[model samples]
Target: MKRRDFLAGTAATGTVLASGLATQASAAEPLKVGFIYLGVPGDGGWTYEHEQARLKMVKHFGNKIETKVIQNVPEGADAERSITQLCLAGCKLIFTTSFGYMDPTINVAKKFPNVKFEMCTGYKDAPNVSNYGGRFYQGRAVIGNIAGHMTKTNKIGYIATFPIPEVVRGINSAFLYARKVNPKAEMKVVWVNTWFDPPKEADAAQALIDSGVDVLMQHTDSTAAMAKAKDAGILAFGQDSDMMQYAPKPRISSIMDNWAPYYIQRAQDVMDGKWTAKDSWLGIDTGIVQVGEISSAVPAAVKADAMALHDRIKAGTEHVFTGPLNKQDGSAWLKAGETASDGALLGMNFYVEGMTGKLPS
Candidate 1:
């Protein structure tokens, strides 16, 4: 969706960050930045968060920058065509915002070697391309702590979008935090398999609740999951963006993907002739991944505790994946004080101990 608030902001287009040369430490050059989105910008979740970052980049650079965005872009052939079109149209710094666009991004980047590429939420990194994302798992930790205290059944339901590491890691993060407060707490995940389908997501939420989950969560994009929770009078955490508005009656808190600042910073690096390929995986400390207002559905005292926990994470005094953990198979996954690393986090393939569900093939 087009954002009206971005009326005066600058946007990225074309190719690499200050890709034209940057032979001199300082050069006054205008840059065109290109952005690709997997869904309509107004889907109100995943795509919206990225657009916010685009608008901020616009505002940050002003006249020296221009942006070209192609929304509702599909992942396959359409992606190759879009990248070609943007490159032909003169985008020197291209940022493809979805994981599916990864190879198309590399394909185009190879053809337009002069252009720099940055793929959000993707793993492939070329000399001209880098990846960036946040520690969404950290937000999951905050929600898990609340779930442990709020659930009457000690059964927390998660409506997961995929078996990809991102979704799996979030499940583990929430489970990690919950077990600390309630040792018997268990997480049950229902994978909807797609990121943006509302009907399937709603069905997943209903199925979980039917199985006796008192608290719910989701990694899917639409508001259907929350709506389902509200209808059933179950508590649930929000996702991607602050989805509280959709299910005010049941929304307990939200894991917000705040992407604006990173966008601005990356684009500014281009403007200032300091752009380079680097992986930026930021978290609560950088104000990138955030959990918004613990709802009144959560008791005030518990809210205080959650915030305290949040602060500890921010200060690096606490890590969500610390040792002394177990997999769902009853095997030890971590020793106390032994935290899982980025490598393991990125390729997580198992469920933690106590989660009742099967991973989809």
Candidate 2:
């Protein structure tokens, strides 16, 4: 859900001085940074990627910064409490890493205006809060291209976490690019709703395989889908992070969400007292989102083709949501040669043509 508009003006220098927060400095005390997560750091996908970046931040800042993490914090009221506790624990900067934590992050930020809040996969921003996320759909297009060429059954399955626009966009991008290369390819979706349930994600993977799917993709934050595909003798792509450790067979490639560079920069910004609220949606060009290793299981030609598409997207010559596109209901959404606007894409709640299954309400 969208929240209040971002505060308009910059924080006056006098505001910081008047608050006396700018004077809190000590050579011995490290600037405290806090991170709140939707799942455990060992989930091996979304949360895992963010945790890796957190580790990177620690390495980059060394003794200059001290970090704290609270894991498995559910969205809504629970998140607000977790964030509040973090602020009370002497954390000067906090990062809430999940889309569902949007409202909670904003609400908590209000009570601690001097504390900086960074939210991942959210659209809202306040004077002390910033929104940042990667364009995951860009990487989806590349993996979908590989899935199109490698699938022997021509049926691709998508294991989804929720019906949010972020998830929907990935589904649409994969379907559009998959069908582009293999006209006979059809996408089948199974929504598990929850983001990091290993059992539920595994069940969904098996269900999709039972439905004759020989290639699998997932929006959930676990390697269960990849493991299931490996056991089923099918192909799959990793979500959020590389799963090539399970590769050479079922896991042919992956969509990697790289947060290290951005995380490091934001930490530096806070240290330099230059951090401000702004929305950041970066992708392959900025190394925020990337395509992971393509295993030897994929044919060389298909790998090359996928990389070419990835390059075009990175160069801005190709758009995943570009036109001659239509909604799932056969309604024209974009005319030929037209590209989707950021507003439309951010609020997308409908599926594109050729994708099967209803978007959850």
The candidate scoring highest on TM-score is: 2
Per-prediction backbone clash count: 27, 0
lDDT of 1 by residue, 226-302 (tens): 88898999998878888869545588888888777677777777666688989888888877888888776677899
Provide the lowest-lDDT 10-residue window in model 1: 1-10
Residue 116's C-alpha lDDT in candidate 2?
95
The whole-model lDDT of each prediction reads 0.82, 0.86
- Please, what are the lDDT tens digits per residue for candidate 2 over residues 1-361? 0000111111233244324543453444788999998898788888998899888667655566799999999988999999999999999999999998999999989999999999998998699999998999999999999999988889999998788999999999998899999999999899887988888899999999999999999998899888889899999988888887888888888888778778877876887779999999898888888898888998899999999999999999999898898899999999999999988989999999887778897
* Ten contiguous residues minimizing lDDT sum, candidate 2: 1-10
